[model samples]
Target: MPDAQLRPEPFIQQTAPAALEDLRARLRATRWPDTPEDAGWSLGTDLDYLRELVTYWAEDFDWPAQEARLARLPRFRVPLGGLGIHFVHARATAPTTPALPLVLSHGWPDSFWRYSKVVPLLTDPGAHGGDPADAFDVVVPDMPGYGYSDRPAGPPLDSVAVAGLWAELMTVLGYERFGAAGGDVGSHVSRYLGLDHPDRVVAVHRTDGGLPVFTGDPADLTQEERSWIDGAAAWGAVEGAYAAIHRTKPQTAAFGLTDSPAGLAAWIVEKLRSWSDSDGDIERSFTKDEILTNITLYWLTGTIGSSMRMYRANAAIPPAQHARRVEVPSGFSLFPGEPVLPPRAWLERTTNMVRLTEPARGGHFAAFEEPEAYAQELRDFFRPYRTGTAAD
Candidate 1:
């Protein structure tokens, strides 16, 4: 049977009253942990802040309202390669012409919520003070085992395997060719899209340099490259222990997160706060509702374990496959506050570097933090590649 005939069905948000009540019960009965007065966030998530947030979550935060808002978007699920993939398919609005198709891949601790703010901006740039010609039909999918998608039931699926699924997903969506972009784990998935589907991918855009894509003779390394390697080592030593746990003992860690909502929040919220460009106040980047909405998705869906297991699967991919050069036309918009901001030379060394821009602000969750800028980056990068354009 043809892939499209898999019959993608409309998906709606309708959490049971029982589930919401149970969540509140858990939050209310949270086993609070004591903290040192001076520890602050030095040891981990601030207990003082978590107490306030949890209070608000149980007493005032609105999941039904958020769910209603999210339900307004066009969302659907389709059976692809035995996995049910949920996605938002937002078409270009009030388009001056037909918009180009674009697929956005996202990483852990987030589902399709990563691009929630940027969707309207990309789909209707005119409403946001941009040209209508810049609009794009955006497809933001919840990767297998994340959000409403089904957990993988067989052998592990790595980035390359996921890319193959994505290529098929685009085909199933009736797109013969499209542009691609992503960051974090999604950036690696996007890399494989360009690497394996150059014939169908119009162009590739990324926020980070998609590390681990570099491996060669030591003699070929430049001083800047050496510095980047050393800096990455330093960053990992301090900030990458969570990933180590995910890679080495995700099942052990998942036990706590899966059973306790508070535990889940601490594990996920720490990253949301630490990796963002919030300075010291994460609220500056994400409101309490925004943070809880993402956390609630994981808590309600029970996918934290599956999400972390992705790291272990990816770790097994051979270096040769990891380091393959991307030949598709590529562009990048490096954010200053993101985990690793690569030099232009480093980007050029990794892919078929075509366009590169360093935005003055934003971080890993740039789309969520700075929607307009992120939307503009996509518009500018994919402008020349759009099929209806004179250049094309």
Candidate 2:
């Protein structure tokens, strides 16, 4: 779709009762895995916790209720770059007038489910107890193969190419210039949006910053930045095994995840528990039902494998292209619990960072876990660039 014409259509989310029953059946039939009593998440996902979650998911968790709530968002699909792009376009109806447009990108193991909580807060800040002037028209897209979006038959699109697709999507939605924000893979996408389409992207915001963008002598970097780089590498050495698997053998892992709902839950819930600011109590970050709903989206859609394949595609990109820097204004929010928290100096020097904040709480899924902070950070960061009719 070099020059794809936009055809936006309303989307309705429905998981067939048969599918729901099938998921329950799968949960019920899960082949148990044995683990040592004291291992308790040190090796991987705790077998006991996963069993507890599976029990709840099979008998108690309600898919229809969760689906109905998610359906309340105004979702739509528009063809862009030879793919069907699904997104929640819950624009701000603030009476202040021209609410700024914001395009949010989601990362792995999750979809638009990530930013659903932040949508209401950003699109209606006044209703959430913030000034109406801070309102924004929120747009959260399911990256190809992640949510209800179409899966690529060939290779999946990488961050740079996906950034191009997003630029086109925003244009189709009539946003000549807008803000871009994301975390995880989304952080990479938002950076590319600022780097590749600076004229169209007013500013960019990210919760995490990764990708080898720096060049020249490492000795020039400050002690904190150098330590951060080394720390990030060490963290990756321990935490990046999943990434390595995704890059090397997503198809092999996808088989079980695609067939067994318990398999899917075990694979994703571990990350949710480990990456959050919850301090090991998973419920502190997300309710049991909330966790199930996220996994259910992947289960019902059968997208776990496709989503994992994106890492393989991303790895194919040349390091030279991945090293491109941003010319547009960039913002960073260093959430306390994210696995690798890059220092402010590293962030600014890496990208054209303007606003940087160390929020007291939240983690990798900050938008879902702490929507208020996420929304407020976005409002504060993009305020300078939102030049239009102010709220009266």
Evaluated at residue 68, the lDDT of candidate 2 is 92
lDDT tens readout by residue for model 1, 1-392: 23647777999979999999999999999999888888888888999888888889899989999999899889999988889999998888878877888999998779899999899999999999999999998999998878888999775578888888888877877787888999888898898999999988999999998554467875687788878877887888988888899888989999999999988998988888887888878898999999999999999999999999998999889989866778999999888778877777777777899998989878898888898999999999998888732112
- For 119-162, candidate 2 gives per-residue lDDT tens digits of 88898888988878878988899999999999998988898889
Model 2 ranges off by over 4 Å = 1-5, 211-215, 388-392
Clash number by candidate, in order? 0, 0
Poorest 10 consecutive residues of model 1 by lDDT?
A: 383-392
Top-TM-score structure, candidate number? 1
- Looking at model 2, report the run of 10 residues with the lowest lDDT sum: 383-392
* Deviation of model 1 at 230, angstroms: 0.8
